[model samples]
Target: MQSDQLIVFAVLAATLGLFVWNRWRYDIVALGALLVVTLAGIVPPEQAFMGLGHPAVITVAAVLVLSRGLLNSGVVDSLARHLTKVGDKPWVQVLTLTAIVALCSGFMNNVGALALFMPVAVWMSRQSGRSPSYLLMPLAFGSLLGGTLTLIGTPPNIIIAGYRREVGEAPFRMFEFLPVGLAITAAGVLLITVLWRLIPRRENQGSDQELFEISAYLTELKVPAQSKYTRRTLHELIAAGGDEAEVMVIALVREGHYQAMPSIYEVLRDEDVLLVEADSDSLKRFLDVTHLELAAEADSKAEAREKAEQEKQAEKNGDTLAQPDANESKTDRHKERALAEAIVTPGSSLIGTTATGLSLRERYGMNVLAVARQGQRLRQRLGKIRFAAGDILLLQAREDQLPSTLSNLGCLPLASRGLRITAPRQVLLASSIFAVALALIAVGVMPAAIALVGAALAMILVGLVPTGDIYKSIDMSIIVLIAAMLPIGEALETTGGSRLIADALLEIGQSAPPAATVAILMAGVMLLSNVVNNAAAAVLAAPVAISLSRGMEASADPLLMAVAIGASCAFLTPIGHQSNTLVMAPGGYRFGDYWRLGLPLSALVVLVAVPVILWVWPL
Candidate 1:
């Protein structure tokens, strides 16, 4: 009830409110809180930015980079192919996919793990005629469960370990979480296997119509006057699309005259609009190699001309940035391009503009293949189609530049079926580097952050990850959120806010047994995690758990374990975890759908994790 404590509590309350309101970005809100505390004299100005360089933030960034390397190497894809052989049984398929995603989560970032396997799950749902909702939630829940097994598995573990170091205890080792984590993960996976039946099977979830709502099948492009394809026959045009870009010319519209199903021997002409049926990747390659123009507003062509003029001016002025390496240019020119889908975020620059207006190819080295906007059929050309928030775009780009390109475009990648073009030797090299990092951490050769940073650097050195994209692989919002929350967490400790909360908990636990107290604390933290970001939950709860244990004169080990486990078990809502939200639109799921499986699975986690923690850590 001190004035300083009251001020800190008020700031904390506002921070939590903004997180739930979600009107503003979470990282912005967190940065605002950090500034408020520093200006109020609660946190010294000199220490205000210390959280940015914290080991936890560094480790999380490194993990994300390493995960991207793993994904690009095609190692996870090779392993997930085995699940396809499990046949069409829903039970067998769900268990197999969930187990693989969960197991991978123990070593890499769990959300990354979920991303890798999502397409596989959707593929299985299609093959088995099961609703995607039945499979996606279990995969998400399993990923959350898997992250609890290792110190580097999730950001919360790294943050909690950093907290332990600050309190004069050795940081938890790499496999310290395995005992309780393994128990809960094994039991939860089993329960999810049986209980997934409770997740209703929406008949439309796997329908062609639902799939088309997110991906368009046909697109129109104008034949440019200088194009080699102008004199070619319709049959020749189809042949030039290549296997990766297999397409069929469905119609020819010339000078506003629509002709359906042009004959194979029919000749093409300049300014003819060809209607074609093809996936995003194929369409891009066909158009690029054929030098066709997607119809666009005149502004797009003008923008491209302006950009080209700026580059020429820079070169004339001897701007070092304007020069591209000869060898690098040669390599890029020869690099094969592939197609992928990205959804425009609410904050995207692409919103309210057509792709041609954005000058995507000239600006970012990417081609917009097709766009899907629900409840509307596009009557215009691809480049002329105006984009809106939530429109999924199929883009074509060089394989190595895809991640950074997506980040730059403010888009989240969607699960798409395509073969990874990386060679086996490169994949092996990337996998070996990752294993070495894990081994170094397991033997205490270095801190987790240092080991991971080294591994990511090695991946770049070996050409597993492109040097230009090293920083892009790291999600800046996550880094900012971690940095900003750390000081807020420390302010809570210094202002005695943590102790006040601890004393209230101690009073309640005094009348109950220690085991019951642990369960109550665990349940409370889990609920807090569902409403707020899990990383913030861990940072706020760790100190209170330490105080609660001291007040009870019990081992701090069990209490800390409780906090770590509870902080990661976010379920019961899509907003609770990023993994859940990633699957919502793809699965065609509604808001209330999560509670059917999440509520029971959450109860199972508390029931199994409490006994395992008490027995292993011994309160």
Candidate 2:
């Protein structure tokens, strides 16, 4: 092999190994690989960062923002709310849910589509008395299957289209994928609906109450007359507890009037009651630091005895007394506050930051009452617990501020409580702008990147998506991964590395039929996608697929189609796609649970896709 080819192969091998290892984020790994290849003189230094401006990167980012616009307008949510009630049968529900999500995934970001329907799935599970595990995996897989339907549906499709444009062929249009994609999606959804029993029935799958049990941690604290913190400001009292204390004051009751989400600057007065949320150890530490006593124990012994005597006398007189139910009392206390259950979104800024580190209570006026991950509640100190993308957080904030707070934190509310439905006029405007963009792409008047970006900008200009949230809506990690990997993919072809690899594959399949060879190539890409980010899988494999097709003297379109379809079949593991991870905790799924349904679906895709590709593209 030539020295340049050797260098490219070595760098790519290391990159693939690091991706499989997954110690670092995929974006960081891709960026590091780009730098190594540039410094080694394989790619010129001036062009090292050129991938940042690639059309695929721009298209992917724009699609994300547009998806956020659709979500904010309540168009998608309204549709989901209605569709989730289509039927009572399990098969009908699964089929309808998967089909709708698939259709949405074709037009918007697949993860966003899955997010919009997750709460609906949970609600359905509750209504039908079935574990969410039966429905969630199918929903997640449906999103993946749907992404194969359109250019803007997923990163892999966009990357493949950009590759075609780079290779002197017209890029694939918006609906060109629809023919084959529709077939594959229909087959996959049917398989999921029929074989739904393959998915494990996990316990406590969709019940937030069972997962967090946050009510047990809520207690009332009273400031007594002799306490040193009686006259101190709320901020001072919190500061006294130190960073290790994870206590949160949800509301203050003074003179029997409730104040929700009280400001830190508010003064603590004698006999004021505070509703606090904390674990036992943190509650004890908070009490020790602030000299606060439990409200139930605050009364004198004589007063307690008198109250007990009154209750006994009333019972003896056979009089009906009005006694508040425990659950009702707790509900009434929190009527002015909002307890939101949200999942940290992929690429959220909150990931890797602890509550104390972010000053969530101080800066955002919200408290992290509890967190759950992969089906179990976290038992560590809340202040010190670093957030992850799929972690479910029990957050306490004011009822009115919950929506914007969750938005700013890069979290998606899992319940309807924090969801905002925009004005009908705004919704209509957002829909019109999106439709115009799609029309432009369909007519070839504008490229996918320009049309989508224009639509995103229009959303911002018209106040559909706020100016402050545009950047937040885009998943920068995905952008960086695509942009950084583009150059490396080009380097692989430029250095003849892809040609060498193609020759080896051709030699191995020298006697196999063309259809079998295509299946092998697609299966290889499918397995690679299961181990790494699907976008990276497509970027690295597209060049090789092109080379393989050329070596076999066949049409490159069929091979590229294989690459696109195979790149999106990341159904074997949660780490394969963000959609899978997002549903893992809520479904209470284990690592082994995926392949039970995924393996068969993958085999079916290979069986169905190869003939479909040949019939459509004429390999």
Candidate 3:
């Protein structure tokens, strides 16, 4: 082994270990690896950042923005609304939902597609009175299947195309993947639809109350005349509870007027009713410290009736509920407060941060009323709980700011029923722009990245995607991961490391038929993807696949296609892909639950993909 190969191999091993350790973020790990290799002189410092300009990275970012545009246009939402009419059968619902999400995944970011449809799937589960577990896993698997359909569908396809270009061939055409991808997707979706029973039917699948049981922790307390905190600001009152207090004051009612998510700066008055969320210990401590008492059941019932009568009278007068006083400005009437449930998205910055650390209430003006993970409410101190991807938060915020807040926080608001359609003109314009870009790519008139970027820009210009949201729509962590990992992949090939690894793989399959070698290669990459990010798996495996092809005296196209298909087969674990992770909490899936369906689907992909790849891009 040459010195450079040894160095590259060491760095690669450490990088993979870090990825599997799942401690640091993948992007940070990749970036650190890139810097290490560059400093070691394995890759020239001058060319270290060149991967940032790679077309694959550009296409992924553009696709994300375009997906947001499609979402904002409400075109997909309109289509998803009709899913309720798809009927009550489990198989029919699974088939229809998976197929649509898969089709959408082919054109846009697969994770984005999955996020958009999750709420709809949950709503469907609720309406049909079934476990969401049956629908969510299939939905996630479908998104992965869909990504195989286009060059821009997933980062791996674009990365594979870039590798093809390096091998002196035209990059894979936009729909060139459709032939093999369509077949694999068809097989996978059918298996999921027919073998839906493979997914575990976990309890509390569709009901938020069952999942979080918020009522168990929510207690209404009152500030009496002698309470020391009565005249202080809400912030001061909460501060009085000391650092160990886990309670949150979610709402305040003063003389029959309700304030949802009242500001912490609001002053507490005598006789005020506070709706608080806290565990038993925290509630007792908070009450002890603040000298506040739990509202009597009689007072609570009377207050409920009084509030209901006020709402009834307001409705009779054609006024909005929670009407502001005459002295209040019109802006107060339009404040539109709401309490909603949101799930933390994969790659969210909030994953490791605590509410106190982020100053969520002070900064985002939202109160974290309660949180649930994997179908059970968390009983620990709320302020100290570190957020994790797929954790469900019960948030109270202004209705208008909720969307952007969730977007900024990298969370997805759970669907609350019904579809909201944007203007017809925006819908037509967004669809037309996307169609034109696809047409351009199909005819070879423009490159995939350029055409898609142009389409994204057009959407921004036309207000289909808000200017404020363009950057937010792009998942920068993914972009950085791809950019940073690209040069490392090249270094593996350039340093002869890939060839060295390829030689060993070739020896293992020397006696096996070439078709078996393809299966082995695809299956190996598939397993790697199940642990690491799929794009990183493709990057590391692409060079090895290319080298393996040369040693076998075969064309590189079939091998590269295998790498592409294998990279997207990140089933068998929630951590394998963002789509899977995003559905875990909502579906009440355990860590081991994935493989029950994933194992079979993975096998099906290998069985269907190898023959199709051989027939389409023969060795």
Q: Clash pairs of candidate 2? A: none
lDDT of 2 by residue, 496-581 (tens): 98898889889889999898888888999999999889999999999999999889988888888999999999999988999998
TM-score of model 3 relative to the true fold? 0.91
Best by lDDT: 3
lDDT of 3 by residue, 474-494 (tens): 899999999999999999999
Clashes of each: 1, 0, 0
- TM-score pick, better of 1 and 2: 2
Give the whole-model CA lDDT for all candidates, comma-separated. 0.79, 0.87, 0.88
Pairs in steric clash, model 1: 245-282
- Of 1 and 2, which scores higher on lDDT? 2
RMSD to the true structure for each prediction, in A, is 13.6, 3.5, 6.0
RMSD of 3: 6.0
Off by over 4 Å in 2: 206-209, 239-246, 284-291, 299-331, 416-419
> Which ranges of candidate 1 are over 4 A from the true structure?
213-271, 276-415
- Lowest summed lDDT across 10 adjacent residues in model 3 is found at 326-335
Q: Model 1: per-residue lDDT, tens digit, 424-460?
A: 9978998899999989998999998899999998988
